[model samples]
Target: MLTVMRHELNMQDRSFSTYLFGFFLLETIGIAAMIYNINNKMANFEYCLSTITLVFVLIIPLITMKSIAEERKLRTDQLLYSLPLSMWDIVLGKFFATLVNFMFPMVFIAVYPLLFKRYGNVYLLTSYGSIIAFIFLGAALIAIGMFVSSLTENQGIAAGISAVIIALNYYSLDLANITSSTKQGSLLVILFFILIIGFIVRSLTKSTLAGVILAALLAAITGIVYLIKSDLFEGLVPSVMSKISFFQRFYAFVNGNFDVTAIVYYVSMTAFFLFLCVQSLEKRRYN
Candidate 1:
């Protein structure tokens, strides 16, 4: 695992892609912070952080697009598959490598609160909490991005999918508002989601029957439950969609509440997606 991490870190140093991503990421965040904190005289660094978080939609793909896609493109993944390491080791090494690279700029950003404290009163607790949440959120997004990268050999395709997924997650709360609230509507939406999941499964496994069976079983269970109790699905689609909104959870810290639940949610998201990445990579061995 450490070997993979070192290799990835070394790869970043060897190529211009990693530095390009880091440059853009830091520049955007720095400009935002400068405009808000210095020019605008805003005391709340968290707001500046919030404004800059949107840049992740652009930068995260850069960080993760080449993690696995390049490995596959270079045919290095074959070497990884034949190595003695377990899937978990490889996945975690790659994830943490990306994570460490991601954390580099954040280290400088962390000093913003102290800088603000020098000028005037800064809400240290809330500011630092939001910063922590922001890091976790970025880590989780990187995990998701890595998994998206693992799905394809084309960096552009991985970047596009990562952008779409991250953007949707960022705006999921707003999107949920447009969804139907009725039980049958929720059921149908869930069925559609299952179909999408089936598509992903089929793409990954190349097993149409397995994907169909899994989707059908899940749809049948959801349909039966909706039929048995129509009331249970009231606004369920919106509610579930809301849960997927990454920025929504971070808002708690921005609002001066150190939300433990939100922190847990981010951690869970990171772990879940990391697991998916491991599975995706592991499947290559069998495929």
Candidate 2:
């Protein structure tokens, strides 16, 4: 694990994309600080983070696109399997290396609250809390991006898919708000997501029977439940979307609330996706 971490970090140090990712994040923070802190005379640095959340859509892919995709492209994943390391070690090493690289700019961003404190009232507690949660959110997304990378050999495809997923997650709450509150609408939405999950389960495990049975079982249960109590599904889709959205969780910190639940949610997401990543690699290892 240490060897993989060191190698990954060394590679990042020499990679142009690594520098570019830092440059872009730092630049976005600078601009956001200027707008929210200077022009608007806002004391809350968290506002800057809120405004710049969209940057992750691009940055997530920027770093994660090539993580596993490039390894597979060059057939280096086989080399990794032969190493005296478990899949957990390799996945965690890559994840921590990329996360450390991300934290480089965050170190500067952390100083912003202190710098602003000199000028006037800055809510350091909430400000720092938001920053911490932001890093957790980034950690979760980085894990997700790596899983996406593990699914493909082409960096561009991985990057594109990651960007789309980030964009959707970033706007999930907003999208949910606009979606129908009707039971029928909610049912449709639930069924749609179930179908997508079914396809995903099939692709990832390479088990059509497993996916089909799981999907069918869930659908049948949903149908029976709906028939018995249709009112239970009223606005269910929007509620689930709001609950599951990563960006929605971040808003609690922005609102001066140090939400422990959100932090736990982010950590859970990171772990779940990292587990999937290990499984993805395990599939290829045996093949």
Candidate maximizing TM-score:
2
> What is the TM-score (0 to 1) of candidate 2?
0.95
Model 1 misses residue 98 by how many Å? 1.1
What lDDT score is found at residue 82 in candidate 2? Answer: 88
The deviation in Å at residue 194 for candidate 2 is: 3.4
RMSD of 2: 1.6
Model 1 — TM-score against the truth?
A: 0.93
Instruction: Summarize candidate 1's per-residue lDDT along 1-287 as a digit string, tens digits.
Output: 99989888888767676777789877987888799889999889888778877888988998899989999999999898888988888888888888888888878888889988999889999899998999999999999999999989999999999999999998889899998988878878888999999998888779999899999999889888888988989999999999888998888899999899888988999999989888888787777
Deviation in Å, model 2, residue 44 alpha carbon: 1.2
Residue 277 lDDT in model 2? 92
Model 2 C-alpha lDDT per residue in residues 23-127, reported as the tens digit of each score? 999999999999989888889999999889999999989999889989999999989988889999999999999999999999999999999999989999999
When summed lDDT is taken over every stretch of 10 residues in candidate 2, the lowest stretch is 278-287
Q: What is the C-alpha RMSD of each candidate to the true structure, in Å?
A: 1.8, 1.6
Residue pairs clashing in model 1 are none
Per-candidate TM-scores read 0.93, 0.95
